[model samples]
Target: MRIKIKKESCTGCRLCEQICTIWHYKEINPKKAAIAIEPHFPEPGIFEPKLCVQCGICAKECPVDAIHLEGEAYVLHADECTNCGICVEACPIDVLYTHADVPTPLKCDLCLKCTEVCNTGALTVVRRSD
Candidate 1:
């Protein structure tokens, strides 16, 4: 499953980011969240929500073979990661981010936790045939 974001409905609340961090890390840190909200000022009420589309670009570009496809999701092997930032650069949508407190790169595993907390219906998970 991949997340579909309705950019117009987003409020830049960061609730999705907060829920993701709390669900995965058991902490309240937005920096650790897999999803990110990029605010667009001067445009007035425009927020871009970046999320993983499960494209597998990061997996294919991992020189160390740290990223692998598991079923429909891409899983990261942190032990094999070299902090090369290759995956981060390989992401077309700029969804992948380097971990703040670790050497491994952080990408969404399509856990759907962020969708649960999205009150504005801005985020939803959809299954892809490919």
Candidate 2:
């Protein structure tokens, strides 16, 4: 699974962030969500979803070797992770945001919650074309 974001369509309303946090953690806080919408202030209007590119930085930086490829997805074995924050530092896009209430890193599952709730059709999930 993969995520696709249309930057041109996002409005910075952050409804995507609201639904993401609620869907994953039963919370309304955007800060707790794995997905992030960054505002490009003073640029008229531009909101871009900082998407997880499924790069293996988290797996590589995991000192405990807890992160691994499971099918097409990168999963964290919660029991094995030490929450060292190494993965967070390793990510080039900084998409590996930490869970607010947990020490472990959070990754996008590509489950389509963001896509389903995108009123602007800005986010999409697809089978990897490759």
Candidate 3:
């Protein structure tokens, strides 16, 4: 299943990001989180959650074939990754991210851990994984 993001409903609490980061990395670092929270300030003051929708563009664009679809989410094999950043650039949704600590491009795996802690219904797991 994929974690559907309702950007307009996001409260900018960053709970999803924190949970995802702690679940995967055992730390409370937003920079290491696969999910991201972006804010639109000034007039409309809303937050946008950047999550993996399993578009598969990152997998198709991987030159080393290191990326693949695993239960509808893009899974990057870090051992096979060359850190070329091609797939990161290929992401249309701009959810794929690169960090100094990570050699492979990181994207959400639809683990649903973030959804468990979300109270605002901003993040939810949908049946569609394809």
Best by lDDT: 1
Rank candidates by lDDT, best first: 1, 3, 2
Query: What's the TM-score of each model vs. the native?
Result: 0.91, 0.88, 0.92
- The top-ranked prediction according to TM-score is 3
Q: Which stretches of model 1 miss by more than 4 angstroms?
A: none
Query: By descending TM-score, how would the candidates be arranged?
Result: 3, 1, 2
TM-score of 1: 0.91
Candidate lDDT (C-alpha), each: 0.85, 0.80, 0.84
How displaced is residue 125 in candidate 3, in Å? 0.9
Instruction: State the local distance difference test value for candidate 2.
Output: 0.80
Tell me which residue pairs clash in candidate 1.
Answer: none
The sequence of per-residue lDDT tens digits that candidate 2 reaches over residues 32-52 is 777899988786568888978
Error of 1 at 15 (Å): 1.1
TM-score comparison, 1 vs 3, better candidate: 3
**Global local distance difference test of model 3:** 0.84
